[model samples]
Target: MAGTTEPYDVITMGRTGVDIYPLQTGVSLADVETFGKFLGGSATNVAVAAARLGRRTAVISRTGRDPFGDYVHKALREFGVDDRWVTPVERYPTPVTFCEIFPPDDFPLYFYRRPKAPDLVIQPEELDLDAIRAARVFWITGTGLCEEPSRSATLAALEARAKSGTTVFDLDWRPLFWGGEGGASGAGGATGATAMATARPYYEAALAHTTVAVGNLDEAEVATGLRDPHACARALLDMGVELAVIKQGPRGVLAVHRDGRTAEVPPTPVEVVNGLGAGDAFGGALCHGLLAGRPLEDVMRHANAAGALVAGRLACSSAMPTADELEKFLASR
Candidate 1:
């Protein structure tokens, strides 16, 4: 499947799966309704977003030999993500997230993740280091670091990319994946803060190889233990990253460079629909902008616009704007 003379602009390495939802508006846990399924995962979302934005993108992940796996592969292809490095396994079942979104407030969404999901079995041998080395940027997430073979596999990919001088972009923190204990599942019904505490080592390992680090206000606070966005961004920069971007949601984004420069790019105005996948859109667009050698301010603006577009739409992947759409939005601003 590795038939290409051209190198990809970005290669995403992390989890891939389907999102099974039983969702409705203004409902509670007791007032559930109909359910729908969608193809989703952080790395997959970023890869699709980058591809749709006219960048050469590839996704390296493992999926089960099940119907959900088939759906994920087909969905990635439909979104123009290059799947040459995807490995389909026969043993483990593809990961499926059974989510119930409590309506009206959009905050109390509950998730049921199956144990030993296919994506969790991503071993080092499953990845093609040559393909990883050929990429300009390697996009990764913190959720994938919650498990064993997948964690080592991601680290190996990053190491290969680092040796080849490829820029590593890390989304520093994800509390849900840490579970209860310090491992995959949580220990003793720990709170979100405790789960986040368990994610520190993974974050530190990722930060060691990252050139660009991106996180929202809450994620930033968790990773660096700093509430101030600027201070958090600065702290991340001090950790050897050349660039740090703190996403402030409706407040926009704050970007800081190692050279002592900073900028705050405001988000574009749009109607809010679903906020899912917006961070991936922003991260993907920011990677695209960096690969294109766009100025820092321009990168933030592009990411902000891309994020706003994702927030304004219903479907996760369907909401990602095209390059032309992003350009138009930027020009108007």
Candidate 2:
């Protein structure tokens, strides 16, 4: 708690799970015989990425009080994130995700988080308002809004920022855990109409408090049901979002400000290896830009380049680049 200073760069709260990725690409999840494991979950991924970039970061969530919980704790420490707010709960097992990642194509995730994952136990009453109020940036995800107590807690985390004027960003996540009975599948795939309807209200509420919203093209359709990037951006602003980012693979990203300013970041060239954690990288780099007080154009470029670097690597947390590494990668362009 001693390190809870004014604007400690970044603070985040949401899902914390283990990711099991197939070691070999271009094969089915069932066909793959070997898998690689790493710390997973959108909010935690963003926290790790920001910390790797030398941002002072803190996390708020719960992990199962078990060995898996220990792994999550160790991972956070390894990344230099302040885990003081990360709680461990009893009885439930930690959630885990399985993905099939083929280069230049698809990454399908199957999540095992049901019955009472520890992250869902996070309650608004347990939140430390001071940390949320004083942070320079707060990152949230749609995954937290998919359920009950966590939903309330997610909204509460934004309340202090709402008053403090902290820059709050929304990361869109369409996990299999949502849209009951295998309804929502794939990122931005129209596979979950029922799930989309179920999630809209919560996402709209989330956007109401967000200063910026970031996600891929499909992620935008999944969150807002608007396919056109510009329309999606406009819809987000209408919901009170100050900035909206609609990511276009290969073509780059288009950012729209509520003030009518628009900028497009050119894509960073890279050999596609795995596209699993690129969005998390973008979220972290965007935090870096905002915390450093860079121009909007520069922010998108930093984020775009960060994402490209991650796409060329494997795993999630390990793929997050350090500041020097990212600068080096950018310098090459």
Candidate 3:
């Protein structure tokens, strides 16, 4: 706990691990000769991205009591993201994720979170309700909803937040994590009608407490059972969020506010590299924009630009642009 009494700019809960990415571009994992290790997990990356843009951020999750866990703490401190709340689970080892960098579009990831991930071991009792409620932005993810203790803990945080400030629900939607039969195809693969059915009730519960919702089209479908962007936005708004952001790959992003305001921004063009952490970058920028009280259109544009920068890079956390980099990229466009 870096002793700071002031409210945090961002507090994200869920997911943390080491990302092992192939350094060689456009190569299969089997043929990859070298790899780069970096701190990862959607929530962790978003926290790092926000920290990169000069926001005071912290993440609430758990890690194993091992070297990887130590690495997690070291990395968070290095990135200026608070790790006071990141505790350790004696049972599970820290999760490790590997990916094959297939450029222009395909990036296949293999998750090594067997028995259970320490992140999913985050129990409600361990949460600091005061910190969560006081943050300027509180972010949670769908991946946290796939399992127990974490699912309950996530909801507890949201409930404590009570729609205060910028409460965001990131519909992460990892099918494999949820045990979906379709693998990574059906909502990241936790699929089949049974998986979707199991997830919706929890999504509904989370949305009831969140003010902002963000996800790609596939994630939106998992949350609302709707594929059309407009409908997905409507369903999210109806579910109780004040804002709904739909990320459409290639085409761009659409943001709809309950106050009858809407912004549709096109994707910023960039040669894709890994394309894995773009959404996390966008999420961090979105939190920054919201905290700054920018117009919805400007927020969407800024987020799109941030994401494009990371999509063109190799690593996720390290690839997040600084405030200067984001401005330069936006000005160049």
Clashes of each: 6, 1, 6
- Write down the worst ten-residue block by lDDT for model 3: 180-189
Model 1 agreement with the true structure over 241-308: per-residue lDDT tens digits = 88888988668889999887788988788766666767788878888888888889988998888988
Report the lDDT tens digits of candidate 3 across residue range 205-248: 99999999999998899889999999999999999999999999
* Stretches of model 2 off by over 4 angstroms after superposition: 1-6, 180-190
How far residue 282's Cα lies from its native spot in candidate 2, in Å, is 0.3
lDDT of 2 at 308: 89
- lDDT by residue (tens digit), candidate 2, 190-269: 55566677777788787788888888777787667888989998887887888889898888899998887899888999
lDDT (CA) per prediction: 0.75, 0.81, 0.92
Give residue 7's lDDT in candidate 3 (0 to 100): 94
- My TM-score estimates for the predictions, one after another, are 0.89, 0.92, 0.96
> Lowest lDDT 10-mer window, candidate 1?
102-111
Query: What is the C-alpha local distance difference test score of candidate 1?
Result: 0.75
Indicate the TM-score of model 2.
Answer: 0.92
Better of 1 and 2 by lDDT: 2
Error of 1 at 218 (Å): 2.5
Clash pairs, candidate 2, are 188-218
